[model samples]
Target chain A: MSTIEIAGKTLELDADGNLANLSDWNEDVARELAKGEGIEELTDRHWQVINYMRKVYQENGDAPSIRKLTKESGVDTKELYSLFPKGPAKKSAKIAGLPKPKGCI
Target chain B: MAEPIEKVSIVISHGSLEGVYPGLIMANGARMEGIEATVFFTFFGLDAIIDKRMDNLGVATVGNPAMRMPGGIKMPTWLGAIPGMSRFATYMMKKEMEKLDIPPVREFIEMIHDAGGEIYACKATVDMFHLSENDFCSSLDEIITVGEFYEKSAGAKIIFT
Candidate 1:
């Protein structure tokens, strides 16, 4: 079991990726998570991925892959590249406040 | 690994539609990194956030050499406003979005708001343009002055693109 605190609520991530504290998650948590990722300012496009990721994680209890993110979020791969400039997985996941993704290092 | 710098706030000011997207794109990028992002629309830039003309924006071809056809056929600035040209350019942009599979501007703005980010309109520009609050896009949180905007964006990065 693993523990994470988002927006002042404690959450648990089991081996299967289930959230024990789903009610604690909210847009404010996403904002705080974004803040921790170094996003002090925000834009409409940024929210697109953050919101989608939160929804996907809450539903599937598993993080989205880059391909799944693009498909589900409806943001173009090129535009995603342009938005992240660094690369989608690392940067986007960081801002979305998800845990460090696998295979990112 | 190197440690990361703290979040930086970026301010984007633009009037033209073509010019505005860069600001939007950059601001979105910054937000993804948890950086502070603010966009200030003045004069023509205000037109972009305003409801009346956001969907129907013009392009800049006068000085852009890269904006050419397959064989480097440069487009003229005068042609940008030639009746159907604005619509054509808008359509071309939409087509590009379709090709990239990016969402529309409306959806993008909604995403920002849902994430608890802020969107503000320029008070002075709004007054100068004779646009009431009702004329602005529904996503706007408030109408603020340059000074107010500066205060909010201070202590963060600033970008004018």
Candidate 2:
């Protein structure tokens, strides 16, 4: 476990770097996290994925997998990868302050 | 930073709905973790890449000893061979997958490709089926020989399903 300080608040992260407490998530925290992920800017497209992930997590009790993220999140698979780079689902879930997706590995 | 399992090569050899999905799901999962993924389709698994048959994959209910009914009772193989049983099983499986937001075969393959995952069909299988490249989905990267697949899979973790 570790802590990342954002906007004067410390938030917990698990060993895999996902937010330990979902309640600590906010736009500011997401922006800071995104920057660390090589995204200097969080465009509307980035927010589209982030918000969609958070919404789905709230409804489903887990982050959407990459398949669902691409098909139902209003972001195509190509765009999602470009926006989040490397691993879209894991990165977006980290930025959205959600747990590591259930079956990401 | 050290490269985390740089690539994963998966082989899908069965055409049944159950047989095909594990490879797809694992490949997709690999991409989600930033690992490069490649899926090699051969034998009956070729159905998963065929343009017309990919989306219509059916469950192999007959002779599957592990299949069970909704209440967890073992599904007798005799019952599985009844007409329309395969279709019913397929529908039930699709519904379960849908409830979990798992995509259909076509969309799943597209998602893997769009995410930079490589998809391949076995050349011999293509020849056996008399399938042209056009018979496969556009996302297929190529139809290559087994030797060629092994060459490309060098240094990667290979999963046979």
Candidate 1's C-alpha runs over 4 A off are A1-105, B1-13, B62-65, B76-82
Q: Encode model 2's per-residue lDDT on B1-161: one tens digit a residue.
A: 87579889999999989999999999988888788889999999999999989989999888889999889999999999999999998999999898787889998889889988999999999999888999999999999999999999998999999
What does the lDDT read for residue B9 in candidate 1? Answer: 38
Candidate 1 CAPRI grade:
incorrect
**Candidate 1 TM-score restricted to chain A:** 0.58
Which lDDT values do the candidates have, in the order given? Answer: 0.62, 0.90
Best candidate, lDDT: 2
State the DockQ of every prediction.
0.07, 0.61
**Interface RMSD values for the candidates, listed in order?**
9.0, 2.2
Docking class of 2: medium
lDDT of 1 by residue, B1-161 (tens): 88564334334455555777776666555555445556666667776767877766666545665665425577776655467765566677778755553445655554444333467788887888788889888778889988898788767656666
Single out the weakest 10-residue window by summed lDDT for candidate 2 chain A. A96-105
lDDT of 2 at B114: 91
